[model samples]
Target: MFQDEARFGRMVRIRRCWAPKPARPMVGNGYEREFLYVYGAVSSLQGQFDWMITHIMNTTHMSEFLAQVSSAHRRDFIVMVVDGASSHKAHDLVVPENMRLLRLPPYSPELNPQEHVWDELREKEFPNRVFNDLESVRRQLEDGLPRLAANRASIRSLTAWPWIVSINLNAH
Candidate 1:
């Protein structure tokens, strides 16, 4: 599974949208600094996705998210591909017994399929929208994650690159 973390917040990014010619489109802007972190893992071959929303990004939270993913897939040994985040390499980080971390080379976000998941969420769930509060942002994430998870076909389509599907994890 490819793993990564994303920060979501009340800050809104104005995305391009279609507007009738000669009509000006109004986009709302948000500058609040409040933020939350989401930890996610996607299995491209199986189209299985796991995610957790957290108040902070730290070793403890990373460990907890690992545990959650481990619990969700008790029988499968997960070789999680992750980036070189400080929390990911913390000396005291608790990696679950059924999982192993494989670090991607520095400055290679494009290699992780999990990034496409974030792009999908931002494009679909948060396009041109401004949240009134942190809770509203959280609620949107809560809704989006499961909706994405339930659509196995969509998950596979978004993340299952040819190279990714070709690799053998030896899960048997």
Candidate 2:
């Protein structure tokens, strides 16, 4: 039940989590942390600041709103997947100083951990809903991120059926 984005006319529904903690914060005293889950896309350039697409393969736009995943131990990262995504195969992508690309099994979105990211972003974090504008959506997601990150199980459960109703809707 991962979240997916579809282009509808000119609007896009970007399912995302908002966890913008300062890159470097003062150590150990009392710091404020915030988290949010937002839906909808930026319709205009100004709106882009308010919303973003999570875990998208695209190279353009907010790097601040996204993060890349990799394993430090290659010995433990034995699972090789063949995700036939153009971005996975794109030659122009600028990964970290040294990163290797692996292909996931063709058409196997179910096996991807990222699938749960969108699913839970739209489900547990954000119940059935829509946003009127990008600001409102951003604020909502920004607030939801902390709770979402704390409960890793909640996000992982996104792959399960009951929580994945919307995710499986288009499968038929």
Candidate 3:
């Protein structure tokens, strides 16, 4: 929802571009997939105390991380969580034991600040992104995370989402 590209794609396909003819051209291998999700946080303007957790990368991971983060931050002042994953409720993977998960509702990405952080991170830092393989991309993301941690504001924004920063506190 950060840039609203994916949602726009969905909307266009559903509305503007309806199917009619059986004749069509195949495009590429159809292996390209957009794995989107980020651990982000929202500060109370001044930015002192922060809520953090392990970010959910994919749907499989999102449910579990969501469950874990929800539990750890249940009592915190920063208990609000904003997310737009259908799997968060439909899939048990997004929900952990003893944790309550909340959804950002449909077509509501603006509520999630983490989306903005991820957009900035991807476009600004990972410009002209090219990777040899999935492992290469994974390694780059891992490397960027630690660096992201250094920025209190960014980290706070990044983990403000439900399933990222708080999960770490649970592990300890």
Give the top-scoring candidate (TM-score).
1
Q: Which tens-of-lDDT digit does each residue in 76-127 have in candidate 3? A: 4333454554544454454444444455667777666655555555654454
Best-fitting candidate, scored by lDDT: 1
Model 1, position 118: C-alpha lDDT score? 95
| lDDT for model 3 | 0.44
Question: Stretches of candidate 1 above 4 Å error?
Answer: 19-23
Worst 10 residues of 2 by lDDT: 41-50
TM-score attained by model 1? 0.95
Model 3, position 70: C-alpha lDDT score = 52
Alpha-carbon RMSD to native, per candidate: 1.4, 15.7, 11.8
> Candidate 2, residues 1-172: lDDT per residue as tens digits?
1222321111233343454675432222212222232222111111111224342335432122222222222222222222564543556544433233456567776655444455545565444244445455555566664555555455435433433233322211
RMSD of 2: 15.7
Q: Residue 65 deviation, candidate 1, in Å?
A: 0.4
The estimated TM-scores of all candidates read 0.95, 0.45, 0.51
Structure candidate 1, residue pairs in collision:
none
* Model 2: lDDT of residue 79: 23
Better of 1 and 2 by TM-score: 1
Instruction: List runs of model 3 lying over 4 Å from the truth.
Output: 1-60, 67-80, 91-99, 155-172
